[model samples]
Target chain A: MSGIRLVGVLGGMGPAATVDFYGKLVEETAATCDQGHVPVVIWGDPRVPDRSLSLLGGGEDPTPYLRRGVEALKQAGCEVLAVPCNTAHAFVPRLAEEAGLELVSIIEVTAEALAADGVRAAGVLATSGTLHAGLYANALRRYGVAAIEPDEPGQRRVMAAIGAVKSGGVRPAHRRALEEVARSLADRGAERIVTACTELVLAMDGSHVPVPVLDPARLLARRVAGMALGAALTG
Target chain B: MSGIRLVGVLGGMGPAATVDFYGKLVEETAATCDQGHVPVVIWGDPRVPDRSLSLLGGGEDPTPYLRRGVEALKQAGCEVLAVPCNTAHAFVPRLAEEAGLELVSIIEVTAEALAADGVRAAGVLATSGTLHAGLYANALRRYGVAAIEPDEPGQRRVMAAIGAVKSGGVRPAHRRALEEVARSLADRGAERIVTACTELVLAMDGSHVPVPVLDPARLLARRVAGMALGAALTG
Candidate 1:
């Protein structure tokens, strides 16, 4: 309890995305040796019911599983928590209240980053569940930043690309579909595009997009690292 | 209590190596969807006293810290455990007996793999602590395989390359040193070279070696994944 704060990750909303986030967390930390890195405990339960399907009323409730993960982390002596999945954050408010630990919000951190950079309008690329729940939109709206969502056709393509990433691997077609939707969003006055979905973050390369890309997972990783290292808290 | 076994990782011997091991775990799993992947809990405490330093009698004992990690993972409900660090295997015998959980050994898996492939003599590249502890040498000997270690000067280069991977990043000098040692070992009647140290596995590209490279971390990852997924356990 006296050393660096132990960080807990509630992961495996999809196993690959969680690994990606952990890699980013390692990369973001300023460490000169093995001892300089933060301590972390991860409860990566891939068996948690699909967050999107659950939110869309097509799958079992994932709240129980999510709660179980949080409880395990707490029992393991985690001082703070991070959930890497965007759709999973739809349940964060209640989870945070019951978790009794500081839960870093990926959505809040992404919105704050946009607001701090003077972004007035930003395009969001995420799963239908995140969009349906308005997780990013609601967070960004509070900061007076407009969240531009993909149109119905564009969103369908986004979903297809995300699915391709999860099922096997992303194909050229999936990348092209994501690129088209990103351009469409940029055409609709999106100053910057946010890859809110972890799956899209894995599938879409930022260089292919029309505008600058904001990766919420990377942002959240940095925030968590800073907190664990006892650095001044910044958005 | 009766679902898929939760795999626990006793990691953070160095953060990057642990991340590399977890990434390999994800890649080795035959998962078509999120739920298809195995559940995992990782106690990644970078503050665990340096295994190499402690083994050299130059740093604090790491046993207490290692035991603490084991207890935490147990409390978190992990069914099986894996330690990614090669040097840490020196403590595994005692830890396993007390852990009340199945601990997958990187050293044993690597040896078994070599034996299965009909490799008679294998070059082992690892930290000084691992060489000093004879973790790989003893494990290979049990399978009637000869363990070929680097000469004095070559051992120094292996250590330097490992340090380079831990401190900042691998440089050309580090890669060249590793390549030279690998060639020297191959010239000494070695059939295959084992990247026993996790850091060396990260720094050395497999294709650069003259002989086929055996990565123990990858072997352990597949074993842990199989155990969790209820697949038949194989060497």
Candidate 2:
């Protein structure tokens, strides 16, 4: 049904995260020339009701907005869709079914990646919405990878770091707070740490972490590129 | 028509340049929160026939592909448009007329910026396609800003630097070559240097240019952001 599948990005869960995902997609593609890069149709509707706020019962439903974005991308010729925000994956299955487009789940993809890498247990750093909805927890469990989350206070720190990044305060304090949480998770026997939140990926610079950090956004970019290019995926 | 205008990005003249433009748009927006950022519908079709080759009499016309992108962005509700590629602007006035979208001209924006900044003469660094079509030259002259282009050998180096960037070969040597060209232009009494080519923007780090570098893309981004936010335009 395709020559090259167009990658639809359901973005603007946060504007910066969407831009970061697009940049990573360009960087991960094995293109010798510009034409070799994947074709992307980004529906960056910043109006999408905030996912975390909804999951926390503090905001409106994001389903309708997400559905509209999916429809727009499909109309624009995207054969496969990916939402860069991890919290947004809660609506993926339903939206993917409704849109009839192959949706790439950041949670499922990351869990599969962890299982494939023989990780028995992994630490997750994400928004309270993601943890509350069991987005990563359920996926990891289904993939036979135990999900370890930071303690309540640690989770608060993660949320604060995420908030700082979204507010354009990607300072060293934000990174340090995340690193401290990652270290605490590693102390509790997490073999690897998953930066499940896109904002957290922006905050933490992948340095000085106690364990190896797994960035699902980067993985999703590689997967999207491989699928678009019809190449064996490896990252 | 009553609300803030949606920004349509006619992109993928080269994938990296599109990303750079989007990033700049996000950065330049006067946003204190995620919702404050502009809504962008990007039609990043990498398969658009090469603009430079088409302009230089070596490739198919890019008009059809550009029209499709503009149409898609319009259908997705982009009220205003901007194309990041300077070479792509050769088709802008016509496409903007046909598509009935208010397209922001990077060349015009830069020339206006130069004139506003009280600069009488400026040097241009861009692809042969842009130079040959006099995109910046004509726009600068219209604004009473004298446009100075690289001499034959210097032009060759600039073209090579652009090719290096397009092929994803952004080596230090490429940056050095472009810097040498900029320095030579400065030596010839050019007061301000206009980085008319997006690729050249990628190569030169903007740290050590002898004179001020007027980045048209950055100017375009700021303009697009200001327009979308309904703010007074200033660079």
Candidate 3:
């Protein structure tokens, strides 16, 4: 039997999202037996300073903690790396460079998926850090797709929903807030909605959205699974 | 805020079970925010040689692979360890000793839980390897709780259901088979049913069973979360 690549997940920007990504990865892989699935090593350090808080210049810089996670994954012999949090991807390039590992960019993959689907415009739902950093915007721009973002009030709703998910289970209020923001984005001519925040993916279901939903975390999981199983070429 | 301990999960005996365990851990934590949850590092090497096959002397030894996982977790700075698979507990004693980390035994925790509940006899649903190893029987015996196992035919059904879950998603057939066995065990005077196998925990829901179900994985997750969050003492 051919060997599968060991994929490392640098996670716990919030613990639930990391678990969500891992679960999706297992579901996406074409494995008949236990050994047929991809081997994974995850460093889920929830203590890593909040990515959004840091990006907004209000909290401690998460670089050192993120670097520690990358080093641990590299030491454990992971050939490829995936960071589940969209905001955390802002630091992924530097971490991948320092660790000399093939890091899968969730933003790039989502953009590529949108372009492949002939989507001209997509609404992004993510943390303030991810929106401020333009991680998804820049990637989507490169694919010739227009990235629509939430208005200030909508963004607040998005952040509130995200906070609700992170703090505990998603209540009906959180889901309703996200659905409203998604509907507003759709009314503004968004062809599809991208759940850029991992926590948002947990809160908002695709069926409840006004338009088709694109989950970056699930896309990342599928890409990582494909790479590990050798079903798709590792880029 | 006080620091939470990093718990290492040596998993992927079947990838889905590990995901289930981690998800439960996240849910069980008294976290209102991401950092309030336990930090975790998982070495999910699905490639580990089959624990059941090894115990039955029909396949390669899983010791070296398990040792590799233990060493990887130790190097990652995990202060405590948990293995999600019930069959894997057969090697937990040696691995804990070799790694010098506190390894939480799912079997022992389950027994403790049963004893605390004043359960006199409990039905166990697990893999043949775990049955052969007498992990639950011995642990439960220590707590003065009688462990009732499936008869030979029922055991075969249990193994088949586990294999079904590992191969892919659990089907209605698999759940039906397990429910039947659980019913038979209940009819035989089992006070409670212990879903000793992690995979069985995934396939069979507690409400569907004839008696109250105790999931060792959930218990393990709760125990580890408590220990990590300083809610309970680490044994």
**lDDT for each residue of candidate 1 in B20-134, tens digit (9 for 90 to 100):** 9988988998777888887999899988888988898898899999999998888888879899999999886588669798988898899999999999999999988999888
Candidate 3 lDDT by residue in tens digits, B1-235 = 4456789999999899999999999989878888778889999999999999999889999999999999999999998999999999998779988889998999989999999999999999989999998999999999999999999999999999899889886789889989999999999989999999999888886677778999999999999998887843333
Any runs in candidate 2 off by more than 4 Å, and if so which?
Answer: A231-235, B231-235
List the candidate numbers ranked by DockQ, top first: 3, 1, 2
Which has the greatest lDDT?
A: 3
What is candidate 1's CAPRI-style docking category based on DockQ?
high
How far out, in Å, is residue B115 in model 1? 0.3
Per-candidate clash tally:
0, 0, 0
Question: Fnat of the models, one by one?
Answer: 0.91, 0.69, 0.93
Model 2, B1-235: lDDT tens digits are 2467888898887889988898899889866567778888998888888888899999999999898999898888787999989999998778788878998889888988999998988999988999999898888889998889999999999988887777788888888888888988888888999989887788887667789988888999999888887742232
True lDDT of residue A125, candidate 1: 95
Per-residue accuracy of model 3 over A102-196 as CA lDDT, tens digit each: 99999989999999999999999999999999898899999999999999999999999999889986789888889989989999989999999
Extract clashing residue pairs from model 1.
none
User: TM-score of each candidate?
Assistant: 0.97, 0.96, 0.97
